[model samples]
Target: MALRPAPVGTGIVFTRIDQGNALLPAAYDLVSETRLGTTLRNGDGVGLAAVEHLMAALWGCEIDNLFVDIDGPEVPAMDGSAAPFVFLMECAGVVEQGASRQAVRVCRSVEVIDGDKRIALTPADDFSVDLLIDFDNPMIARQSSCFHGGSFAFKTEISRARTFGFENEVAALHAAGFALGGSLENAVVVGEDRVLNEGGLRYDNEFVRHKTLDCVGDLYLAGAPLLAHVDAHCSGHGLNNAVLRALFASDRNWKLEPVMSALPSWSETAVAAEA
Candidate 1:
């Protein structure tokens, strides 16, 4: 797949170049599946899966409008992290268009609970997340990560953290047709007592960091940048998307705010390109 710049207000959209140029908007309303990953389906029932990593890269890089051209049903899982996508975006360069940035500001807290999994969003001036996870595996007994969005390095902290799975579950996942492309080169495989990957981990707390990264991508489907403090526990794509739905179900819950001085890193490039 390839990503290209779009005009102002275009938002993020995926185009099936091989399928009659069908376009699907990357919005929560179009989300049709979120089992192991997030999937967006267009009106005609076409879908694109494994989009969380790409979405997180776009969100982190402050990319507002873009067109993704794909020829398959799922995104290429390059390195199983957002780093590859981020590198591509950087090489293509970011350019701020002549339009005001916008965001959805939360007015009240919205929460979703499915057994022990929980997710919530509360009013805040900036985007932030506090995530926690508990697994029976000793390699990842309990891990937590907190990110004050836009104030840290997404490249080093989150982009390199790969998705993890238990060694014993690899066969089942493959037999079930999930993670068909997953491997040690793209995922962190954990055994009963140690990491199966030769390269250990990018961070000691990589588990929670990657989860936090996934949460950021899932919530981006809200169709706008978010200005809210998010707290989640043992939640995956399902709960993450649920909180976004709940937050938007009520008009009183969130309101769109025009962003000022958006895309600072890309402003120079934009100006230079236009000149």
Candidate 2:
């Protein structure tokens, strides 16, 4: 896969090189599935999977426009964290297009409830996330995290948190065509009573941190930076997408706000090459 620069207002687009260069805009309305991870499909039925991590990295890096060229159905699961992608962006370098940035500002709260799980977005001056997760496994009984958006905060606090799974669910997940590429090298494996990874958790609350990372990625599908406070509990990819749908259900829920400057860590003007 390659990350290429896009013209201003291009947003984030995934180009399926292997599928005749089918263009799939990374937008919430195009989301086709969220069983194991997020998937976006075009009108041709061409689809891409596991885009959450990469999307999160783009959001964290403040990459407003880019073209992702890939040859497979899923993004590479490098370390199962957004950290690698962040590094790639740093290596590729970010340049601000000569255009003002735009954001989706929530005008009111929108919520989705499913049993004990729920997610909501409310008006805020900046993007932030408050997320919590609960699992039956004692190793991850309950974990909570909050993120106030910025490249530094995401890279240092959220990007290194790797995806995790339960040992017992491997077979079922495999049968369901999920996590076919998952392994100890790419994901944290929780065994009967402990983390099976050699180094254990990156952070004491890494599980929740990773979930927040995923939330950041999932929410970026809104097509612009969000100026809102996201509150979620036991939310996964599906619920994240559902909340986005709810947020855009009415014109009264959000408005686009234009910022006259570029994000920090980037020049106010320049051009970027494909990386």
Could you list the CA RMSD of all candidates, in the order they appear?
2.8, 2.1
The lDDT leader among the candidates is: 2
- Per-residue error for 201 in candidate 1, Å, reads 0.6
Error of 2 at 180 (Å): 6.2
Each model's total of backbone clashes: 1, 0
Residue 255 displacement (Å), model 1: 0.4
Q: TM-score: which candidate is best?
A: 2
User: Lowest-lDDT window of 10 residues in candidate 1?
Assistant: 266-275
Give the whole-model CA lDDT for all candidates, comma-separated: 0.84, 0.89
Predicted candidate 2 versus true structure: per-residue lDDT over 147-194, tens digit per residue: 985778999999999999888887678888876865788999998899
Query: How would you encode candidate 1's per-residue C-alpha lDDT over 44-77 as one tens digit per residue?
Result: 9888998898888888878888888899988888
TM values, all candidates? 0.93, 0.94
Candidate 1 lands at a TM-score of 0.93
Per-residue lDDT of 16 in model 1: 88
Worst 10 residues of 2 by lDDT: 262-271
